[model samples]
Target: MSVNPFPEMDSVSTAEPEPSPFDPIPRGEPVPDWEEARIVWKSTWNIHVYGFATIFLLFTIFSTYRFLKLYSFKAARMSNGYQLKLGLYIAICLFSLLRSLVLFTDAYNSWNIFPPILAKVLWSLAYPCLIGAFTVLLAVLLATTNACHRGKSLASSYKHGIGMGCCLLGYTALVVTADWAVMYSQRSIFLLVLCQVIFIAWGTIVMIGYASIACKITRDLSRTPLNVDRGLLRSFARLLCVCSVIGGICILMKFYAAVSTFSSRSESEDSPQPWRWLAFETTQRAIECSMCLLLILITGRADRKREILVVPKIMCNGITIISGLESGTVLKDIRLKDKQIIH
Candidate 1:
């Protein structure tokens, strides 16, 4: 018998390296076990938030329908800028509802079941919409207080709406490039959340200031039945402030999540209270929904005020009947005239 001098050669064997359990982490693509994330949400989140979110979604849809009816009912009362402001408000509500729906779907799937590009696009669209909503709010307050009113002023709300559309486009471009080019890295996401938190806080302050002015102005209009009281304004401001704080907390959690995710600490920390994205989203939607419901209530009350006076509902037939034919007049003149028929 002879002992082999080099035993290292004898140990060679046939085996393949383990396949990737998931795609690159930067892509934010979920691994196979990502479905287990549902358990994390189930254990950690407040059940009530979920309940509120459901109610909110349904209520918002109903409110939107009612608002459209209200628009038709008193079409002549609202100026073009005013109509545009209301339209923007609806857009905000729609976006908020969309976010809630996406969150529910994410929880149900236990991961970002949304494709990377789609996920990025949706998120990108969200920020601008949210910011635009607030911008219109500010614009309305400014308009009501002074000549800042668009469709009625040099600085038009229509321009703001158009600007927001542009913003959405810009953000979409940025996010698509970032997600694909940069891998949606932890540092980048963390920084993004941090900036969002700061902006949220600042925005809350701005909202409070503007809302205070709006409330004061509304109170002076004793003759107008639709004048919103200071109480409602205060409530809205307070809610905005609260949401801002919550936003900060959520950003922190997101930062930690990004950190843990990238460092692979999630595997080692077997804690039951796993911070979850779905839970954060639920909380966010709960707060936002509450705010939106309040706005809907206010708008609904304002619109129906005439009903209390027993005004009959205006019915618009599908016909655009015109009186004397003015050849030289442009489309604007007709639109203005059409808008003059009040309920």
Candidate 2:
């Protein structure tokens, strides 16, 4: 029967406070349904990405196996060119294996089979290996061409080794720093853009290096004598050109991906179909596998040529001499009788 004079106070006391727009999600709680949907969609696309990585892994493993088998007994005697190639193959195997694992973890993370953080950790580990592999591959290509022309290993130079090591370390540090900034800092977009810029610069430098090497090889091939194997030099030059083209394409794709990601972030958009990104990654992996296959084939041919030109020992005047029959040449006889008597 009595009217309440403090109705506004009672209503205010009973009403719940609205959440702030800047509120952080509580830990150990599910994200919004939309966020979960985006995560699932992205992770699902990782299945195709990892599938391509698996194929690349198989190719790297086969390459490493073939290289090892081809040089099984010659490891100790391998030139710097071969050693660099061996290192490149090993690094690629590690990179591909880690990359596949990372992608698989991402795919599984969507289903809660693996933690999301695990995929990030795997990626962090894999990226450095990728840089290392790329460094070694570049070194091998340069060294191979130089060795072919000089008839000696350029990679054996201490200065060259030091320069390569410094470059690898510097790039690894840059990548790690960029990844750390992306994962931990609030200014992720700026850091991501910086990383992409760095990548573009690196790609440009690599393309230039390949171009110069290709040009030098072409010049040498034109002026080299008929006895030199022109085909091998041409093949290496072609490979360098191919690599440059592939690297340029990858850089452009990466730039596009970075632009899209930044635009999506700015728009507060989620659940952009993952297929576009995954398709780009799949194409990259396929190209890498094909390049590795080509490298293995080319190296195999070089090894066969070396085997064919290997001289057989012949006994002459109770002393050993190397026959150059396969090479269509003769060598001066070394009189070892006096040296043997002195020994």
State every prediction's TM-score relative to the real structure.
0.56, 0.66
In model 2, pairs of residues that clash are none
Off by over 4 Å in 2: 1-50, 75-78, 112-114, 124-127, 147-160, 188-190, 274-278, 294-343
Tens-place lDDT digits, model 1, residues 75-189? 4244324554565557666666766665556533245587655665555455555545554554543443333222354335346467546654565455455555434444455
lDDT value, candidate 2, whole model? 0.54
* Top-TM-score structure, candidate number: 2
Error of 1 at 72 (Å): 2.3
The count of backbone overlaps in candidate 2 is 0
Q: lDDT values of the candidates?
A: 0.47, 0.54
| Residue 103, model 1: Cα distance from true site in angstroms | 3.7
* Highest lDDT against the true fold, candidate: 2
